[model samples]
Target: MSLLQTLPSLPSDAAYDLVVIGAGGAGLSAALHAAIDGAKVLVVERTAHVGGTTAWSAGTTWIPCTRHAKGVADEDSLERAARYLDRVVGDHADAALRRAFLAHGAEAVERFEQHSDVHYRPYALHPDYESDVDGSTLRGRALEPLPFDGRQLGALFGLLRPPIPEFTVLGGMMVDRTDINHLLSMGRSWPSLRHAVKIVARHAHDRLRHPRGTRLVMGNALVARLLHSLAQRPRVTLLMDTQMREIHVSDGHPGPGRSIEAVTLESAGTSRRIAVRGGLALASGGINRDPVWRERHLPGIPMDWCPGAPGHTGQAQALALQIGARHGQGAASPTFWAPVSRRQRADGSTAVFPHFVMDRAKPGMLTVNQAGRRYLNESMSYHRYGLAMQAEQCRSEAGEPGAAAALPSWIVCDAAALKRHGLGMVRPGGGGLAPFIADGYLRHGATLADLAHQLGMDAATLEATVATHNRHAEAGHDPDFQRGVTAYQRNIGDATWPGRNPNLGALTAGPYYAVQVVPGDIGAAVGLQTDDQARVLDAQGMPIGGLYAVGNDAQSIMGGTYPGPGITIGPGMVFGFLAARDAWRRCRSA
Candidate 1:
């Protein structure tokens, strides 16, 4: 059944103690926890799907010192977590918000595990992005959503939002951290072969009854578990394809004078006003979809290649701004970024793939500017790669002769890397790559000089760059940027390679390939200013009653830095809990 079919019809004048706008991980979590606190809650989703961009994510939360991590041998404590935050964020992080996140983030995860069926599992080997930072550990800081059985939800499984199709294999069969390894080693290992066979059989069974594979995992699992938990809450209601048109103030004007009253909503072309007693939680994804705002904050970049969902166009930020909510300026870039490559699918539609992992960290691949000179440590996270791209662009502009072609970079790799790691959506070891080359989706040449000429890059410069890289790669060292030196880099690097340096394989194979790479953001970072309690604040730094912002909709408490995996959703979920509980307290007192 569709999500709308499962929803109850809205009453003519229905009201709720708390109204949550947007039904992603953060909004849904707020609604679920608020209902558990005995407050009547309603979730208004702009799209028919429940999960927003969170559904497109990896479902890992970079929350430190949770119950899931406490049992690990090298356990992380709140004190250490505080130290990490202080060093990573510096003056950018809000002192109060930082303290609050460390204090309540663990409790928030614990509360949900105790009261809801949704659960998280700690990664024993995953290290923080900045492994050298104080309080950083090699494990026990990142928590990923445990795999969920979609059969538990039954027909409601269709109501759960799906993950990015690019993340899946075998026609939409979702996989988790362990599942990927099992699938990758299918032919050589008996246990992997069995796992692959079981997955295929299950997907075949699901195809008979569903349009897409029903064996959900990863982000889909996270959303499904939350949906199931929310369904069990008697006081919670979810309405899909509902738009929050406008927000009304108590005095019929703006200025944050305790004026949050109600919201005007339009569903199926019919507008209705619903009163609110507690407050509104803004979790409408973020501003990645708004080009005007993107230009203002993140200049010289296009918003066409983002991985964010369709509905995150700064709706929540705009609504809050109507009542004098200040736009919080971040010390870091106004957005989180990733390098993206676009390809036309078989259906004639364009498919944009985010190079999140499995590409840059692999040996034999590197990125270069128009001059064919290498820049950056190619083994870092996608967020860092994006920043490096922009910084290179800026540096090129300052230098002479290289400024002409540095705005749009290119990812160059050898035949080995292309066959092993794959470029964008062109799978590794796949036979049919002629069409991709013919269509200009991929550029190839028989030799390095020929490839450089074809790509409009300097031939001598390209040759020198490869020679320098090969000299270092042969010895398992990267002198330029020290690639693969950090634990985080090596973890993402290829383990199958029997070499001293996992991320430093020389690109010396036959034919070389190059693909266009542009600066692309995964989501917006700058957003509404809020206090420690999550209440939206004004220009004067005063809390605006009845207004709270969480997730990407608010200025990231990480101070615009991507600390680790799930940084976006983890704090979003925590603050969502804080916002809902605060609303419960205010409503109960009333």
Candidate 2:
């Protein structure tokens, strides 16, 4: 019997007009919008729950020309946005594709807010990755989610993931840089007072009545709220622990009319195929967590930075490949890899690269290789960060006499830096930074040379680098490397400093500590190619009927560089909105 014949058929249920694969920030955004357009929607998630890696994200959505940019109306323009993108992505991006993102991104945000519970607060404060680039305004391009009550999620709370404890979640938390500084100040000013009391009180209340203990709210808090809105809708059906195995394609008569008839899914011990008369939207996230695929696609870098779901192994990508979908080629390998650090959870298992890297509450110190040499700019963009790590490894291999190999860099800080800038090394429930120091994970040394020896580096070289850096610190000018020069860098730097460079410091104090740093990735930037409408393209760059991808699973339209905080989610939502609109149009036309 054929595979279709061998499988028991599902009952003649109502054919879903739309099938969205992943439930991440991107996938859910697409599904909610499709449902709003009055399409019968079914969202399938591979994990036991939904929310994907977004639950752990900082929840900032970056968009240029947003309502927040109204004050600086004269500074930003569509042409400027285009120019900035051209400089960053270069010839890698198609002009049409870039135009699509810029033109539709604002509309998509407005549409999402109108149809769903995803309310956006215009943040006039966020910075662009490169503020100096044309169309790159200092503000008005980014908006973050307003805090929501997780208690509303109810029993569905267990179906969602919780934010890491190190992050504050009470009082509608915003994980931006300023919020972190507030958290730190609260801790220091009132040492005896509970720093996060409001958050804890709300969390405790939710735990008492809610089945999941705490309601989940995080990065793009509005996105999660929006998903909750859809879950409450009578029309939307969310299937947890279900995986889409393949898409059933119809070989239509030779024309621009071939389409998908249904999608086959595997759940529990049984398999069922759901007919897709309208269209199938693949928002299943990227291939950042799949070790096998990472080894194949991004062989050069370590898989450290991925904050995506464990099941986000490109199942949708694989399904597309099986359907003869053509893959796009550019750099032959992933230009960026998510860099993360290994943090041991309470259960003994390790959680890699929580939002601490981006959280202002905890400052991310500079990373040095095993040989105690600084390799890359600590404040560089994530894509550039990955490239720097890889370059460091290459330099180590060349062995130009006595070069230190860059295996994994160390995040060094003195007691003052630790106190001023929080370290993510605290125990799950325990307060204070004792555990990290008590355990060998965070090593403390009295002097620069002693710290170098402890980190297994050439003592003289490390001492000299520190001394030279100190001279720059004393003069309040970084000559060798401009550490706190850029807005992006200064945004993450120590705001308490009187000088312009917030990231600059002497590192002259005793009891210096070092936390080993690894290349932690947010997600893979490369994936299957798509058009401006989020349509999957074949080898000839033609749209594949009934197949569309958005978010990380789709090749980043911005090439490998991150223009702003929400660049990933912003486009993901925009393309997702476009795909839903196009799918509706296609279904209605048929």
Best candidate (score: TM-score): 1
lDDT of 2 by residue, 1-590 (tens): 11011123436554777888988888888888888888877888887666776766767777767665677554777788888888877766566878998898788888877777787776655678786566677677777777776656656656665554445444333344444444556656664235445545655675566543343444635545866778656667777778888788887332344578888888777688788967788877787777777788666555544555577787789888777565555632363444455666668866665423442212324567777766666666555566666777777788765456665777776666666555444422224556666766667778877888888888897777667666766776666546667777676565667654667666767767776656666666787888888888876667878788888888887777767777778888888888889888888998
Query: Root-mean-square deviation of each candidate, in angstroms?
Result: 2.1, 4.5
Model 1 has a clash total of 0
Assess candidate 1 and give its TM-score to the true structure.
0.96
Per-residue lDDT of model 1, residues 490-521, tens digit only:
98888888767999888887699988877678
lDDT of 2: 0.68
The parts of candidate 2 lying over 4 Å away from their true place are 1-10, 72-74, 165-179, 187-197, 210-217, 252-257, 300-305, 331-339, 354-365, 401-403, 426-431
- Pick by lDDT: which candidate is best? 1
